[model samples]
Target chain A: MTLLTIVLLAVITFTTRYLFLHPSLPVKLGPKMVSFLNFSAPAVLTAIWVPIIFVHEGELNVNPLNPFVLSATIAVIISAKTKNIYWTVGVSLAVFVAMKFFL
Target chain B: MLTKKQATIKMIQKGIIDMLPLNLAVIPWGILCGSLAIQRDFTVLEALLMPMIVFAGAAQLVATELIAENAPLLTILFTVFIISSRHFLYGLALRQKLKVLPLKKRVALGFVLTDELFALSTDKKSLKGKLRLTYGVSAGFSFYFSWLFFNIVGIVAGAYLPDLTTLGLDFAIAVTFIALVIPTITSLPVLVAVCVSGVLSVVLKLMGWELDLVIASLVGMYSGYLTLRFTNQNQLNEPEK
Candidate 1:
């Protein structure tokens, strides 16, 4: 089962990973597609984050007092502001631990 | 001095460097997967080899669930097929980007074309044409190797990893997902797509549609795309009036 799982999934992932640009496939996915693909990244980000960043454990845990929430928010802002992913990640870790343990 | 060969080798090295962030995301996932596989009765060798061969987290999860349930082999095969539908889209996307490559290289690249590497490599406008062959292969191999390493780490640690959920490794996927989306949210149609995707996912979950996760994902992507096209056409027609 393990080997089967790995081989099958790897095959699928690899195929699609590079599937976008295959020739002779009638990729009528012209100008709008490029734009749509452009939009997908951030929109998908929102779809994933809003659920967690705004809510937690399936509840609305929106409060500055929530360390996990706070840390993540700070991290997002820092990431956006500085575009420094390393600091954003590091700061978030520190904030999450500090706020969760101490606060 | 073989300087160019060394430079070519750097291609793979560059892949490793770029994938560091991706590797962090892969760790807990690998660990969680490893632990789960063990609980389901996979031998150590089986557990370790799976991630090496398949290397995809979600597909592995779905496959494990099916196996544990003792679903018929056909049912297991179907589930695997459904879970793998994303790769078709992935392949479609890469088709034009890679046609110039010889068949063997394309097939080989296809082998290592996981989600992380594909998303990262395609966006490099600097890597158009056959040049992408080198870059993509390098990146693909790096991610594949990284996955193998961390997966082994996770499988070994799976015995010791208690309440793996508490480790909050999920956030790695969340963070990576967020990072993936940050580049795409520039328009209302796209925003609508995200909302649609989320609402559909939640609704499907509520409706007890166990397999709807990826289905909802496709719903979200294509619907959002059509909506964007519709609105654009409406705007164009409005000018003629």
Candidate 2:
């Protein structure tokens, strides 16, 4: 069953990516649709991250002592300022470890 | 101007070099995904083949998690499809340049069209004709190779290493997403969409919704679309003043 899921996912992913590459299927997405697609990255990524950070064991955990939330907050600030992945990952992991050991 | 052959070679080399930083950044996530696959009880072959076949880091991670939860096959497939829909935009952006290639080459390139490769190859100033094709292929395959290499290492090493889950390394994926999202929150519409989707996802998850991720993503997209439309209308009205 897992194998089948992986294969199906690969097929769908390849198809979506290859859809416009074919000359036979000329797709002309309008400006509105394009703009919507532009937002997909930010929207999807944020949605994915939020649950992981704020939710623990299927419940919301927003306490200040929660290491994940604290590290993520620091990481978000660093990422926004530096726009660099290395610093974001480094600082987040460091903070998470520090909080894990000390707090 | 350089000869065609020289230009093609230079472009390919440039593509490989340009992808280095992102490839480095992807290593930890790839390893994390690999380790998670092992923890999920996936066979060595299954874990190794995933990055090579799926070529999507986040989608693979999500699918692994869903599969481990014993979710139905259809649900897993649908979730991955939704997560990967962003590739459609990448395809759209490269359509004109890629159309000139033969069907076979186009298919091959499409399989490897990742976010980094697309960004590197679609520079309107640097890429043209055969050079564009070569450069994209070079970058795509380089990313593919590095991703597979690190994932394999993780899978193999995961067998010997202590339980990784206790270390909270899984949070790296969330951190990666934060890094990705921070740079993109430039416009009000984008900000609205991100915040709405993010908060809604947590709210729905707390409600015990089975498909909170998918529902949240769709709602977010809709909110962004509406924001864009509203802003455009306002701009048109302001022109009259």
Candidate 3:
């Protein structure tokens, strides 16, 4: 069952990726669809991270002392300011480690 | 100016080198995910093959967590599909730019398409010509191997260190996601979309919705689209100053 699930995962992911890129496929998207897709990446990413950052051990943890919140706050600011992944990740990880140590 | 072959080589090299920083960032999560999978009773071979085949760190992470809970196979597969469906948008975004390449190359490129590769290859300056294909594929291959390598290290180390999860290294995944998503909120509509989706996801999770992630994302996309249209309508309605 596990092996089957793993193989199916690969197939599903590859199909999602390959559908539009297939040279002979008749997949034509409208401009509105393209514009809407422009938001999917950010929206999907946000949805994924929010649960991890906000929920700890099945409870909501929104306090500043929460290491996830502090690190993510700094990460957001740095990512927006520098638009650099290295800085955003480096400093955020540093803050996360520091928070874990003190609190 | 360089010859065609020279340009191709240079672009491929650039792809490999350009992915170095992200590859580094991906290492911790990749290792952690490998360890998590192994801890979830995945055989060493299964842990290694998961990353190599799925090539999606985030989706694999989600899938493993569900597997740990002894979730149903259909549920796990559904969650992974929803998590990875974002790649559909990536394929659509790049199809035009990549259509110039032959069908075989296009298929290969699609197979390896990743968030990092999409970001790297879609930079405004490089979004042209066959060079994009060369660079995209090379970058994807580079990141893909690095991910698999990191997973191997994680699997080996996880075998000995049963408490790898206690180190709080999982926070790195959440933080990495923050860094990845923040820079992409380039406009007000995107901002609106992100906030709506994020808050809605939390709400749905709290309510114990079965497919909160998928539902939240669709709502978020719709909110963003509506915001864009609203902003445009406002501009059109405003009289010339």
Candidate 4:
């Protein structure tokens, strides 16, 4: 079953990727659909990350002192200001480590 | 003859330049995955294969983590399915740009349609017609090689590496999104859409929705869509502005 999971994951991912490559792969998209999918990039991401940040084991981590949360907020501000991934991650991770040490 | 080869090289360089900004974050995530796969008792072969096969850092991370927790196979499958559905939207956005390419090239390109590639390819308007396509292909394949090489690096070091997560690399993924979003977030509408989506995501979580992530995203998307539609209708009612 473990082997099957790995193999199935590989095949399925490759297929989705292949669908993107195959020009004749008729994208079932109409105008309305295209417009809707436009937001999928961010929308889908939000679905995955929000839970990780807010609820851990079904409890809100409202303690504004969590390293990861503080790091992410600082990261967002840095990213918004500079739009650079390297700096944003660098600053956030550094700040997080500092926070861990200090408080 | 020189112009032909030079043009191809130009396209490739443009593709690389476009991708470099995003790759900074992507690289660490790949490294973290490679390192973690080893920590979780994945053999060298499995460590190497996970990124190559799954081809997504986040999904693969989630999948491996779930597998470690003794989750049901069906649950793992469903989780991957949910995460991968993001590709459908990427496909939608690239439709017109890719409409004219032959199937063979499209398939080749599809294998590397990552968020990095998508972000790079979409923002580029320099290469028009045939030249544009060559540019796109170069971008996709460059990412492919980078991914392959990074996975091997991860697999090789899997045994000796400390906790990749403890190293605080996961934050890189979220930072990557912020980096990508900033460029496209120039307009008021786009700003509103992102804030609404992000805030609603937190709100939905507070409301105790188990699938708040998916629901919050849907709320953000719908809000953006309807706002656009309303603005368009109002414009139509008036003369061209």
Candidate maximizing lDDT:
3
**Candidate 1, residue B109: lDDT:** 76
Q: Candidate 2, residues B45-145: lDDT per residue as tens digits?
A: 88877897887877888888898999988888888887777677667666666777888889889989876665455335434667766877888889999
- lDDT by residue (tens digit), candidate 4, A1-103: 6667888887667665555544566556677666665666665554455455555555577576787677777777887788776787688867877887897
TM-score for candidate 3, residues paired by index: 0.85
Clashing residue pairs in candidate 3 are none
Poorly placed runs, candidate 2 (over 4 Å): A1-9, A19-27, B1-21, B35-43, B58-101, B114-136, B208-211, B238-241
Ranking by lDDT: 3, 2, 4, 1
Q: What is the DockQ of the complex in model 1? A: 0.35
The global Cα lDDT (0 to 1) of model 4 is 0.69
Q: Give the TM-score comparing model 1 with the true structure, all chains together.
A: 0.76
- All models, RMSD in angstroms: 4.3, 4.2, 3.3, 3.6
Superposition error at B16 for model 2 (Å): 4.4
- For B12-100, candidate 4 gives per-residue lDDT tens digits of 79887776655655677777777777778777777667777678876788888887777998888877876666676566567666656
Give the per-residue lDDT of model 3 (tens digit) for B28-124: 8778888888888898777877898877877888888887798998888888887777777788777666766787887788888887777665454
RMSD of 4: 3.6
Task: Kindly provide the TM-score of model 2 when superposed on the true structure, using C-alpha atoms.
Answer: 0.76
Candidate with top TM-score is: 3
Residue A53, model 4: lDDT of: 53
